[model samples]
Target: MSVNNKTVWLTGASSGIGLALARQLANQGARLILTSRREQQLEELRQSLPNSEQHQVLALDLNQPEKAKETASAALKNTPVDILINNAGVSQRSPAMETDLTVYRTLMEVDYFSVVALNQVVLADMVKRRNGHIVTVSSVAGKVGTKLRSGYSGAKFAVIGYMDCLRAEMAEHNVRCTTVLPGFVHTQIAHNALTGDGSLRGKEDQDNASGISPEQCAADIIRAIESNKAEVISGKGMSKVAPLLQRFFPGLLRKMLANR
Candidate 1:
């Protein structure tokens, strides 16, 4: 599961944890394929990495699942993706009651279906090679549901289940699947989250503003991968506490979340 010297394909490479991961992975000597909608930003990221010439930028819009899969599958023809980190996703900031149905679908498209699409595209090669690792960046919201996040939670929860099932079937093929639940990291996720009417939230949440840095989150994830962990929760304080409460004291957790 070590990323060192492996070929890693990462999505959401333009910013946040994905960007942090790109730097760390490249520093670890992994050849990289950086994917995101921001081609210019991805190019800048590539230039900033160590041994910059070793990495590549493949601009992809996860919103377009079929095109993304096709593009990634074509890249597979030239190079193998030893580690596929499905990190490109959007969040939601509207209540389930207020959320538009289309908003939910949009969340599913970017946060769940897109992950599935990319995984399927790369997994065929992994199974054939009998080697590979899939690291999906899910969220703490998926673990402990709260107000104004039904769509986001649903999509994140869906991906966790999908990766788990994928892990089960891929076990025989020796491919690994690791689901990472990261709490409110200081990223643009909140700012870019969808509102009830399908517009951007355009504001950072208080929790996000005070959360762990993306670099810290990325470092923890890299450690999880190297250790071959099945699941890892990356964060501090409430991020580390809520899930425990959810599993051991659901009623209390529900009451607490209702007030948030």
Candidate 2:
């Protein structure tokens, strides 16, 4: 789908990939509705965008399942979303056996359920109008199991499954769904990820600090949307090899990851 002048809603727009995409789409002439938990950052992002009134900032907590439809409705008050970028997500890093149930709940709410809820809200309208694109920002973890990323992988895998099903359901309706699996992007996700204590991790992971930039990730996402791709994977090393390794040598991959 062409992004020119399209109305798009991007969640988690305060920073990282969402912020990068907001800037790119805004420059491409798309009307944007940006949402995140940080109003101040969202305001700052709004200032950097091209369109003033055409773009809006709504601070929202994706942890609240009921808030998904409400937030979408609020955004619709400003303009219809021709594209929904379900980018807001939380990550968790701990031994799955040691991970707290609370962290699991929070991860599921923010990373999986919230996206599903918001999609349901906008789907009816899109189906009726027969023109819409849903771009879900998942991760390479969605396709391969990795150590210290059980919850994160679970949520992203759920997104891939749901979007795959949604694609089949919407095939005859003229709606498009694209799931993007980025390997690792230079974003605040690692710092923002929930720790064992239900607090954000204070330190950045080695991989996150040395990963691809969000601008590069966003460019790939935009290209995938333009092509209406069902799925697109980004990054070099682990990004390219993980899927192949998972498919052909699952036991070896598991052992390799454990050693890492």
lDDT, each prediction: 0.91, 0.87
| lDDT of candidate 2 at residue 175, scale 0 to 100 | 93
CA shift of 113, model 1, Å: 0.5
Top-lDDT structure, candidate number: 1
Query: What C-alpha lDDT does candidate 1 achieve relative to the native structure?
Result: 0.91
User: Which pairs clash in model 1?
Assistant: none
Candidate 2 residue-wise lDDT, 1-260, digit = tens: 78988988899888889989999999999988888888898888898788777788778889996875786676575366799999988887788888888888889899999988888878988998898999999999999978888888999999899999999999999999999999888888998888776888867898877889999999999999999999999876876679889999999988988898
1-260: candidate 1 lDDT, tens digit per residue: 67889999999988899999998999999999999999999998899899899899999889888888998788778788899999888988887889999999988988998899999888888999999999999999878888899988999889889988998999999999999999889999999999999999999989999999999999999998999889999999988789999999999999988886
Candidate 1 lDDT trough over 10 residues, lowest sum: 72-81
